[model samples]
Target: MTGARTADPPYLASLRAGYDRAFEATVVATPPEGVVLSQSLFYPVGGGQEADHGTLVTPDGIRVAVVDVRRMSGAVVHRLEKGGLVRFRIGMTVRGEIDWARRYTHMRLHTAQHLLSALAFDRYGLRTSEAAMSGHGGYLDLEGMLDGEEPIRRLEEEANSRYFTQPVQVESAMVSRAEFEAMPGRSSAKSLPQGISSVRLVLIEGIDRCPCGGTHVLSTGEVGRVRVFRDPKGKVASTRLSFELLEEREGPSSPP
Candidate 1:
């Protein structure tokens, strides 16, 4: 039952820039499902990405666990664990911090998807029909077939070689809907709803550009080496590339 507010939320702020994992904001309302913060960095579930889990600390030092986040009716609702709702109230100030390990893994996996999708489209004229990411790994379903394991091996090798040698930088920006629609290899933007005049495009340097609202690493190097293979559950017409970050000496570890 939170009323409308004008302040830009933290997730939107980080949408085109570096992510701020922790933030402080006022509680605007406490609906039955969760607390509505005046501003929050927690990413709600959307764009085939998972919601961010975190903790919210009240001004009086009581720590409440934020078990889930969702965007409801234009507001970001931070759902608390059972019995944690009583610690918050309208107008109360709180500090929120996301689970960095999970968020970072998501960032890496998401960027890896973009990389692999770009490679597939560029090398084989295949378009990504779907993509989903998790702390464990991610997958992209392409509109074409890989024919055999050799193509998969080549795709994986090219992705890893680019990561180690070229290290493409990833960045996001807002473009006019017209510009987004005009860009080549932007089949993904076709799914965007109407009335959106502007679109956020995630660009992997010279590699690819696509409309996306998910968090990503700053560079392909941060994604480290990836293992790209055929998904056993893929449909008959489409080829699914299942991928995960291989553990590297300097890269983030896979979630347990």
Candidate 2:
């Protein structure tokens, strides 16, 4: 926690600036689990989103593969592969670069999840209980029952319509916890830790506004086409809806 500060890390701080794939930071602490940087662009695993995989290059030209990232005691820890610990020392400058292909896919799938979740909540009064994102697709577990394929079909149609036709813009902002709680239709506020005084809200234009820490695309159009389906393994009390982005003629794209 040598360089730890109360302000948001580089990954969260740059989210509104369209985020960064690479960054230069100084090694501030070397904990038993991993190394902490003065600033970092690697996203740690949280909010149902996976951690970012990347590489950290030392000033002396040794490349250390970052296998995992996690937030520990208010610090972002970049866990490196074996033998990487000896290559870095406190106060040394290093360059970090995230795996863009994997990160871009995450951005697309995460935004698509938001659209689908918003639609489900508005159309059927369902609340999203859990979500998991992957390179190929993602899924959202709703708190209520969603019977049959008709609802899934309709949701899929609505999501694609918004993506291809209307193309809603996505934006994010940091707000006081009190301000966020006062806002209408706020969800999952109580689940946040009591020490967090600020909340980050992701707005999908007029469609959705909820508390989220995950990365997302700048617009719905970047999600391409989506395919929504019901997961049979969902709990009896809740419905799990999964989605995959269809292949586009333009192929995979990155967020700006």
Candidate 3:
């Protein structure tokens, strides 16, 4: 199968493929105790840290816990847990399983961060230069020097307004260089990957156009509820916007 970066595109978890039988895979190479799977739905840890967690089920009815998922030279490598090694092997077809519950939650939270960042940039013109995902939460570093409570509160309001209105739509597409360029206020050339032949553009309709290699939902509504845990006393001008997606709530009782 063509190495469709499609898996990493935002909204893939909400994608039908996630619920389908194992997607597609090819035997890459055999390691000491496990096998390397090519074209895996598993997202190996990249950018900073936090590896993807899941399990790999073998044809022999044995399951190996995917302790660590990482990347090297464009290939995703899964390290199996001890005592679960025999179940997996090179040249053997196995089912790649992900903790959808955990993975989906991450997708929702991650997308929420993007939306919040876009809001800050749009309303306050904050210029963010770096970001990283940690276990506690994710944070972005902006160049803007800020010091006050009002600014933080303002950012919260802007994000909640569009969020509640359900205006954001996270969609993906594989477009040519020209098509990618047509989007308004698109990331400039200096930000783009060098020698890029084709690009995958993830559009946050009406807000931002980002070249992202991560899973996301079809629409902003799927994000359920968002909690912006902004830290006003953040050490310098840099603001730390920690957030999480609230679990879906049950419907209330209907009137008699």
Candidate 4:
């Protein structure tokens, strides 16, 4: 994908809290399908993760549905829904926002992914190849093959234990690729984009650490219980482990 959070250019603001923050951004470029923004809180489709969907509204309240967000040459491109091509203009300033529920769901799942990847490597010496998430569930593709439901069951057990069981905090930081390489962690199946010399590393207190760019919850407990699917057939050349979140139904979780 686009490396990790460290890969973010200095000109753009951190999307860590973009869903709650409103910013005025000028349109930098407009193709037939989408427009590039000066800065974006929307997580684009990268690292096997899906792009965010949302709306862009003018200061006058004129709004357009943003169907997709993609990254091209370091810029975040917002693709509008069908019709309304003229709703935006190159130089026009608008308020860019993302679907909060979708973004937060991804945040939770992505963090869980980091946990899963770390567990696989720590317990089985397998490194993650690729991953993608939706809603409260997603899958992790690793380099090795897995057999039987027992392995997956063990994953569920370790994941729940390794994840937030005692209210530990989650953290993100930018580090050069050299530091990323030196540190102990799981590496994704895909390499970071060319020319990227830095990475954003996500850390879970007492659990695991890895480089990632997707949004994530502040606390590990908010990630809830990680449940893995019990199917050996899902394994191909690479083992594809699927997992979902069983969020605590009690109340809202505090941000880390």
TM-scores of all models?
A: 0.91, 0.91, 0.78, 0.84
The lowest-lDDT stretch of 10 consecutive residues in candidate 3 is: 247-256
For model 4, the stretches where C-alpha displacement exceeds 4 angstroms are: 1-21, 162-165, 188-190, 230-237, 248-256
Give per-residue CA lDDT, model 4, range 1-256, as digits (tens).
1321113432123434533534577877677657777767677887756777888997679888888877766667778878755777777888976676676777778778888887888888888877888767898887887777787788888778856454567777778877776775566424666677977777777767777777766676767887887435445678888888777332233221
In candidate 2, how many Å is residue 48 off?
A: 0.6
lDDT of 1 by residue, 106-159 (tens): 878888888898899999999998999876688999987789899999999999
Global lDDT of each model? 0.80, 0.80, 0.59, 0.70
lDDT of 2 at 193: 74
* Model 2 regions lying over 4 Å from their true place: 1-7, 14-18, 164-166, 186-188, 248-255
Give the candidate order by descending TM-score.
1, 2, 4, 3
- How large an RMSD does model 3 have? 5.6
- Count of backbone collisions in candidate 3: 3
What would the TM-score be for candidate 4 when compared with the true structure?
0.84
Please identify which of the two predictions, 1 or 3, would achieve the higher lDDT against the true structure: 1
When 1 and 3 are scored with TM-score, the better candidate is 1
Clashes of each: 0, 0, 3, 3
User: lDDT for model 1, on a 0 to 1 scale?
Assistant: 0.80
How much is the lDDT of residue 138 in candidate 1? 87
